[model samples]
Target chain A: MTKQTPLALWRRPTFWPVALLALLWLLNAALTPNFARIEVRDGRLFGSLIDVIHRGAPVMLLAVGMTLVIAMRGIDLSVGSVMAMAGAVAAQLIAVHDAPLAVVVAVPLVVAAAAGLWNGLLVTLAGMQPIVATLILLVAGRGVAQLITGGQITTFERPAFQFLGTGALLGVPFTLWLVAGVTLLVGALLRLTPLGLYVESIGGNERAARLAGVRVRAIKVAGYVLTGLCAGLAGLIATADIKAADVSNCGLYIELDAILAVVLGGTSLSGGRARMVGALAGALIMQTLTTTMLMRGIGQEYALVIKAVVALLVCLIYTPRFRGALQRLVGREVHAA
Target chain B: MSLLRRNIPLLASVAVYAALYVGASLAYHHFCSLRVLINLFEENAPLGLTAVGMTFVILAGGIDLSVGSVMALCSIVIAVLIEQHGWHPLAALALALGLSTLLGTGMGCIIHYLQIAPFIVTLAGMFFARGLALIISVEPVPIRAAGHAWLGGLGIPLTGQLDIPITALVFLGALFVAAYVTVLTPIGRSVYALGGDEEAALLMGLRIGRTKVFVYTVSGFCSGLAGVLFTLYQSAGNPSAGVGMELDAIAAVVVGGTLLTGGVGGVCGTLIGVLIFGTIQTAIIFDGRLSSWWTRVAIGTLLLLFVLLQRALTSATGRRKAQHVSG
Candidate 1:
């Protein structure tokens, strides 16, 4: 093989997302005062940059699973609700049952996985569209969480549980470590096994894969179960960070963010291509955008507007029709010139 | 029998709605009162209007998540203008409705022209409308317009204790108009054709762009109308009002007997859906034991049941078609 060169890396599709993220980071550093300022306090790193990643941990975790799900041409809109449910389960277990940390964490993850399994069965067995299948949970999952928490924001304070949110293991945020570990573990699993290829094949063409003897149903269910696990962990992080599980508000609109991140990371909604690093960068880009606006003293109302504009711009840029129109317009000018 | 089989979903919704009303009438001593029955129409007037529009959009095989945001925006614009700017209620309503319809047209243009997903385009619309509304005023604004109150006051008296409000009358008028349009109008037929199969419709010389745009325009207008009527009904316009109304409308449409895949349901089913929705809320309120959140849970369960029933019906038809082909 030809010697790998830095210039050759530019051909990679993932390079653009990473480069965009870096450009955004640099812009934040230049514009927002003290944006690049980093501090070490109590042996833990702290700063706006750190804060963005720390806050973005939940989305980053979600992006990993969402990448896989979207690669399978399916979406899990219930991630936000699953987050709420998981958080509620954890909070109730801690506050009401006075469960240990292991039980507090384990039970919620299991519950979240069960919710994923429900979605999987609905889509695969019921043969319902993925959107319709997940829409059920999206609608009712929050109510179930409210039922569990008795329609109250359940708060629990256990030092170990809180550490998952607040504590540091090695002068860095625990959330960062958790995210990194999960990403690496998932990445390794995807790389070292045929699971990723099977997922891609399933997304590329289900009928063909089924004809080839792939267990499409089982694999699809596994993808959802994986997403559920990710959502569960994200929920635990959110709840632990606040020490309260706000049933209605804990993970509101997060699934939208994750979907946007996945899309931004260059995952096709039509299925078959997955990007891990790109999605991570996309989630980071969102966090950075929100932070940059906050630091610039922009009103909260403008944030959604900004997000809409960015999303629209990205959508336009990605559409082949729009691109063709742009090229024809430019080519016409060039011919005239 | 074939017709009935084809519309099993619709008939099922009616049966559920009727059963709920009958069950409530039995469970609660005064549930059958004219007041409660009229209140169902009154309370659900806005939702009914939006869901009716949503039915048309879903029928065309597209979804509009921006309805709630558009409603909130229109409501806010009307409130800000009529209350804060001393504009006439009718003038303010016209402006708000115009702006909302324009927003819908813009979204529809993008979705049609750019070939973007409806979810993404409407999501952008949702954020844009909600952001604009929030920027207008984060606080709730109560209408001080005398005309709003005057219209609110005009209602047909059935009993000494109750009268059908003008809001409900507006909804009923729209419902009749929509039903007539859906059944008789070429545009309505075009919408159904486009929804059932866009490729076939296009090949058959349907104006795909116009139909899609028209569907969104109607949805936008309906949502704006709903907001205006709701403002008159609630006497206030909250920027955050109808935060999740689109999902509720979608649920109502689905539960009322429409498929999300489009071209399989009607506005009448949507009305039954709204009535069912109102019945559940009112029944829970009367029961005193059920919590507010249970309304959502109950709706979800019903939605699931209806979906399964639809699935079974469709599969049965599928089997029949297969058997016919083999024979």
Candidate 2:
């Protein structure tokens, strides 16, 4: 491997996503007064920046799981719906019965893990496409969630359950800490373990990976199960934040956003590459975009438009052809001068 | 043996549809009526149109997640033009279809020029279309135009007390044209060849770019037609309409024997697939024992089965092809 110069490094594919995130933060700071202000409010950190991470915790966690799934040449459209299902299950347990804290948390997490396992089985053993296989749950999982809630937004009145969403630790939001911990853990796993190499080898070329004695099936399955677990935790946080489980709209389109985050993080949709910190940056960028749009009195509808444009621009920037074209255009201008 | 091998997917789809329809007819007395049968097409005309369009995209080795959103945008555009802008109904309809085609072509341009994956490209397209629709109108806009009412009311009386909706006829018309183009046209053949293998098609001197762009444009046109039919059926345009419709369209195409990996499906199969979907919904509704959500579960289950079945059939066919080559 060759050591790249600073200019080359800046021109590398991974640099743009991070730069774009920083640019968005700058934009937010410029537009909103006191956007970067941090103060201890009632023994907790409170500010727009803190709010971004706190709100973005669910997506950040999802991005961590999705990075692995995409790394293995697969996608899990079921994650968003799985979040709803998990939230619904937790909400039902707490609302219907004075269920113990462990039961409420454990049941949903297990159900979500099973959902992930179902997706993994469909993709591996059944020889189905990942998009279509997970799409089955993307469509039906919400119905299952609704059934669990009996077609109602089941609300629970448990302070213990609420703590997962609203509680703080050491002047920082608990959600933020959870997200940071998960991100680091996933990052370490990818960097320090052989699992990451196995995943990349499989995604890069499955036949070659199989020839090299990699357990392609197990790795693929683990990828989805991890994603499911992440989604389940995100769902619990979401339901706890609201104290209610709205199956239909809960976690709606979060999968698309997660995929977008992964893409913006310089991870190719074709797979075989993973980026942990980049995905976190991508998630924060998305949350900041949403927050900025809302702060500017932009309708949620227009926010979708802006996000779509940003995603398209990021995707276009990541394309090698587009980059080549751009560089050639700049080179032409420089030569003419 | 050769004929059996070739027509297995089509045969399988027909068999599935027949079984579901027959079973429903036997179980529910009212399900056997012609009105009930026609109602299936009427209720699902938009889905049928969208599915037909999807078959083209998928057959060309691409997927369009934006069809549902495109349909929604078309409906919104038509409603806004007619009611809010005071434009003629026919003119508004034309403009809506034109806009949809333009959107599709734009997406294709981005995909081809940037060499991006169709899934992510179309995902962005979906958001853009849906957002634009909501921006057009957050609430449902009722079509009070006399022309729209006429269009909506246009129907043919078949038997004693049964009238066929114009929208259903329009669906059938779209299906007919799709079948004709797919079977008899050079462009359609090019689409299939491209999907079968892009490099080979390029080697064979096919118009890869034109065929790719044309398929997406055709899909956009179908979505536009579906949107118009939806508006006519409901007499209003809701921005949120056609939610999850892309999935339904994809499901119909897959169930109809079209391969998701691309290059092996037809409009005829898609038509049957749409009918199977309608039949399932009808059966569940007639049963009344299960909630409507069960339709989603049932469709998901069927989608899974059909995808697995296609995999099996394709593998068998591939094996036979290999044997032939060796022999």
Candidate 3:
């Protein structure tokens, strides 16, 4: 009997998503004159590409974390709220205590990490479902953020803080580089080590994985902590981008976008497998779609409709059932005609 | 005792409701008066109606995150028709309901035929419906006609100092109908069956797709009815009126002891859930010192407590069964 190799296995499921992203990139570049122009002046990046990268940074960070969490057969709907909470804490510390720059930055990150640990504990120790556990934070964290901000926007003017979002290195936004480095680190941890294999096995079948002696609880907790850390980083980028902590709108509906990115990256929502490169490509495609629609002067309402329709179509194409039906229909047409 | 054991969630919900009423009465002496009770119902009638519909959907092992947006869309449609097209209010309401039901059917078809996940399908529906609402009217439309005022609280009456709001009566009627369907009808049993196990239900000769479509249609109808009531209450149709209302409905359902996983809940439980939720908001307001943020914190805490309790109950039952087998 013939044996299938790992290369062939990778080629089967991942090929379509990569090709789709490439096509989208080509379409965007062809439609817009300045879609790819990147320039640096006085150590700051300036370009439409940079704008897309900057806008995509927070979402990319969340999606990276989301990919791992989802691979463990769970989802975290509270990442957006976590981002909001982290931003609120950072802003509050700065506004109230006149905390040093380092303290202000580090405090929120610690809070976010703790929040992630809480989620992990509830799911792992208390045996609550992931969705229900995260739902608590999703509902309450925003209120906590609002409370900290006293229902008001907290604005700041600090160049050192803003540099995280606006600064550049080698003609790329600092946030973009940060995202790349983090993505590489996460990718290596999941790929070049045994962690990735363990995660996939657990997602494939939790009971079987447990029988095989995997520390399922530890891995799941680690995944959530990682997600929380990423949300912390995203919060920093978002707060810096606006230079104002608007708790009301910061990171709203972001969970949906991050989930879409993970799904578009060829990761199954039902869990098991994940792809870091695919997620990056997915992030790029989404940003490009949004930028293209804005550049075309489409109304926000219609733009949203278009995005929903496109997302539905992508999901349909990626799903195995739809692919099978399409292949069967093609075969029938060939036979009948 | 057996009945109570089987319906612990319902009993727990009622206990919470009674506690809320008592607490509210103690905090605000005026809250015990019939006038305040009527006012509370009037204020929350729209949400109560939507929650009833949400209850049905959740019981069927699915969710309708688009209800809020659907309500907004209905409100906009009715408002635009009456004000701009010079259509009769009643006719406009019917048309709005029909359109919303059609939208719900479309969603059900996509979920059933395409095998798309219900969450993603409803999320897309939420976006599409919200976008449609914005397309219809970016700003709120005030109802200037005198006749429309009756839609809010004019139709119903009560004894001196005990007036019933018209919206509340409408909500009560809808709740009655939902209760009848869920408790007495074969269709309701089929819905629960579908939720419990789709494959098993099919083997038992239940029409899974039809029941699902019907449930969503009912939910859409409730949302449409809620929109009309809201329009009457506020005396206007705001395109952004129902933002985040779906989350509230879901929260209420969960608190009322409905399993998010599905197959076990009733409209009565949902009513108690909605009352408890509304009471908490009112109590926080009555206390006067607590921040509005307390409402979120309270709901979140309640949700966690109930979820933990559910987990414990299930595990306890599991361990008992294991013991039975071992013995």
iRMSD for each candidate structure, in the order shown: 0.9, 1.0, 1.1
Q: Name the lDDT value of residue B160 in candidate 3.
A: 61
TM-score of each: 0.96, 0.96, 0.95
Each candidate: what lDDT? Answer: 0.89, 0.90, 0.83
Candidate 2 on A278-309: residue-level lDDT in tens? 88888888899898877778888998888889
Clashing pairs in 3: none
Q: What order do you get sorting by lDDT, best first?
A: 2, 1, 3
Candidate 1 collision pairs: none
Model 2 stretches with alpha carbons more than 4 Å out: A1-8, A329-337, B322-327
lDDT, candidate 1, B16-103, per-residue tens: 9989999999999899988888889989998999998899899999999889888998989999998889999889899999998898
Candidate 2 docking classification: medium
The regions of model 1 sitting more than 4 angstroms off are A1-11, A325-337
Ten contiguous residues minimizing lDDT sum, candidate 1 chain B: B1-10
Task: Say which docking band candidate 1 falls in.
Answer: medium
Query: Residue pairs in steric clash, candidate 2?
Result: none
For candidate 2, what is the recovered fraction of reference interface contacts? 0.67
Report, to 2 decimal places, the DockQ of model 1: 0.75
